[model samples]
Structure formats: C-alpha cells, structure tokens
Target: MMWLAVGAGAALGAWLRWGLSVWLNPVSSWLPLGTWLANLGGGYLMGLAMGAVLAHPHWSAETRLFIMTGFLGGLTTFSTFSSEVLTHLLKGNWVAATGMILLHVCGSVMLTLLGFWQAQQWWGRA
Candidate 1:
C-alpha cells in the first residue's frame, strides 16, 4: 500500500511536470516564467504539506512518504532549473541567468513561507 501510494504520487507528479512544460512552452521566452512558477508552486505546496503533516501527529507516515518523497521529489526539477540557468549564462544572457537564480531561490523561499503561513491559518485553526 505504501509503495502503491508512492508510485501513484510520483506518476501524478511527473504528469504535472510534463503538462506544465508543454503548457508553458509558448511563453518560454517570457523570462523564466515557467520554471519560476513551477518551483514556487512546488515549494509552496511542499511547505504546506510539511506543516500540515507535522502539525497533525496522527497523520500516517505513508502520507508524508508519498507527498514529500514521491510527489515533491519527482515534481521539483532542480536539474532543469540548473540547466536553464546555465543555458542563459552560455547564451550570454547574464541578466536573465542572474535573475533566474535569484528569483527561483528567493521566490521559492518566500512562497514556501507564505504557504506555511496559509496552511497554519487554515489547518492550525482546525
């Protein structure tokens, strides 16, 4: 059952990643919108899930395993982020490369905090 959950979550994550890539392709030239969005969204969800699970001690370990290890691990594309940054640098787009790194790192962190706070407000109240 645990393995099944992991497999399902990973598959879902992969599909979501692919779908986002495809959907964002037309706007790929829009200064790293897709990757930034993906990273921020993933980070936020990760923070929310982590906070929710930790706050709820009764939540099953399988839930954490599936979300953190399977879904988030599969969904967050560090390699792609790195590649995109490198591509920008290699293409002599130093501004874009720097912006991408800073935006991804800082934006992800901020969004994650926002997610945790929202989750706290929502689940903590419950």
Candidate 2:
C-alpha cells in the first residue's frame, strides 16, 4: 500500500512538473520561472500541509506519509533546480544565475514559513 501510494504520488508530481514546465516555457526570459514557481509553491504547500497536520493531532501517520514523503518528496525538484542553475552558469549568465539561486532559496524559505504561520493560525482556530 505504501509503495503504491508513493508510486502514484511520484507519477502525479512528475506530470505536474512537466505540465508546469511546458506552460512556462514560452515566457522563459531571464529567469527560469517554471523552476522558481515550482519550488516556491511546493515549499508553501508542503509547509501548509505540515502545519495542518501538526496543529491537528487527529491526523494519521498514513496521512503524513502521503503528504510529506509521497507528495512533497515527489513535488519538489531540487535536481532540476540545480541543473537550471548550472545551465545558467554554463551559458555565462552569472548574474542571472546567482539571482535565480538566491531568489529561489530565500523566497521558498520565506514563503514556506509564511505558509506554516498561516496554516497554524487557521488550524489553531478550528
């Protein structure tokens, strides 16, 4: 069951990543918008789900496994992030490459924290 859940989640995540990449391919200019958006959104959603689960003690281990290990692990693409950064550097866009790295790292972290805080507040009142 766990393996099945993981497999399903991974497939879904890969599909989502591909879809987003295709959608953002056209407007890709200086920054790699697709990867940035994916990481930030994934981080936020993961934080929100984690916060909800932590706030609500009724959540099961299976739920955590599904969301954290399955969905989130599948959704976030650090490998792609690294590759994109390296591509930018290889293409001699050092400034843009550095900005991308900093923006994604800092923005994702901040957004994730914000999501967690928001979820905590929202779930705490429940």
Candidate 3:
C-alpha cells in the first residue's frame, strides 16, 4: 500500500514537473529557467508540507512519505540542475555556473523558510 501511494504520487509529480518545464523553458534561453523554478517551488511546497505535518501529528508517516519522498523526489530535479551546472563549467561559463549554484541553493532555502514560516503561522492559530 505504501509503495502504491508513493508510485502514484511520483507519477503525478513527474507529469507536473514535465508540464512546467514545457510551459516555461524557452528554446532560445541559455539558462534552464523552468528547472530552477521547479526546484524553488518544490522547496517551498515541501517546507509548507513539513510545517503542516508538524502541526498535525495525526498525519501518517505513509502520507508524509508519499508527499515528500515520492512526490517531491520527482518534482525537484537536482540531478538536472547539477548537469546544467556541469555543462556550464565545461563551456567555461564560470560566472553563470557559480551564479546558478548560488541562486539555486540560497534562493531555494530562503523560499522554503518563507513557506514554512507562513504555514507555521497558520498552524499556530489553529
């Protein structure tokens, strides 16, 4: 049952990730804007989920696994992000590579915190 839940969540996540990429990634752009956005958004969502789960301890571990491990695991593409950074390095675009690395790391964490804090506020009142 757990496996089925995870698999289903992963399938949905992958489709959503693909759709966002197709919708946002422009052919002419050098940077992968779609992937960046996906990761950042995923971070925020994961943080929100974390906050919610913490507030509502009644949520099962399987439920958390389905959303975080299964869904977010598929939604956020760190492997692709690494490959893009590697490609940039190989092409001698050190500045771009560095910037992307910093932005993805820092921006994602900040957004995640923002989402967590916002959700925490709602949970606090509840």
Candidate 4:
C-alpha cells in the first residue's frame, strides 16, 4: 500500500511537472523558467507539508514517504538545474550562471520558509 501511494504520488508529480514545463516552454525560449518554478514550488510544498507533519504527529510514515520522497522527488529537477548552470558556465556566461544559482537557491529557501511560516500560522503555532 505504501509503495502504491508513493508510486501514485510520483506519477502525479511527474505529470504536474511536465504540464508546467509544456505550458512555460513557449513563454521563455532562452531560460529554464519551468524547471525553476517546479523546484521552487516543490520546495514550498515540501516545507508546508513538513510543517504540518511536524505539528500533527499522527501523520503516517507512508504519508511522509509519498510526499517528501515520491512527490518532491519527481517534481524537483536538480540534475536539470545543474546542467543549466553548467551550460551557462561552459558558454562563459558567468553572470547568468551565478544569477541562476543565487536565484534558485535563495528563492527556494525563502519560499520554503514562507510556506513553513504559513503552515505554522494556519496551525496556530508560534
């Protein structure tokens, strides 16, 4: 059952990632905005889910696995991020590479913190 849940969550996450990429592909020809959005969104969701899970200890291990492992594992694309950065570096676009690195790392962390804070507020936690 746990495996089933994880598989289902992974499938859903992968579909969502693909849909977002297809939707954003035409909008930006040079940049990988789709991957950025997916990673940031996945990070935010992971943070939110983690907050809720921490507050509510009754959440099953399977639930955590399905979310943190299955869903986020499929949604976030670290390899693609690395590849994009490497491409920029190889092309001598130091500024772009640094910018992307800072943006992805800092933006994702900030969004995750925001999600965690929102979850805490929703749960009436200080």
For each of the candidates, the C-alpha root-mean-square deviation to the true structure, in angstroms, is 2.0, 1.8, 1.8, 1.7
Worst 10 residues of 1 by lDDT: 25-34
Model 4 vs. true fold: TM = 0.89
- Among the numbered candidates, top lDDT falls to 3
TM-score of each: 0.88, 0.90, 0.92, 0.89
Residue 76, candidate 1: alpha-carbon lDDT: 72
Instruction: Tell me the spans in candidate 4 whose CA falls farther than 4 Å from its real position.
Output: none
For candidate 2, list the clashing residue pairs, or say none.
none
**How far in Å is the alpha carbon of 77 misplaced in model 2?**
0.7
Model 3 lDDT tens row, 1-126? 889778887888888888888888785256688888889999999889889888898988789889988898788888888998999999999998998999888989998998889889989633
Q: For model 3, state the Cα shift of residue 15 in Å.
A: 1.3
Candidate 3 achieves a global lDDT of: 0.85
Query: Candidate 1: misplaced stretches above 4 Å?
Result: none
Better of 1 and 3 by TM-score: 3
* CA-lDDT, candidates in order: 0.80, 0.80, 0.85, 0.84
Residue-level lDDT of model 4, residues 30-117, one tens digit each, is 4688888998999899889878987888989898889988888789878888998899899998988898898788888898898898
- Please estimate how well model 1 matches the true structure, expressed as its whole-model Cα lDDT: 0.80
lDDT tens readout by residue for model 1, 100-126? 888889988998898888888878833
lDDT minimum window of 10 residues, candidate 4: 23-32
Preferred candidate (lDDT higher): 3 or 4: 3
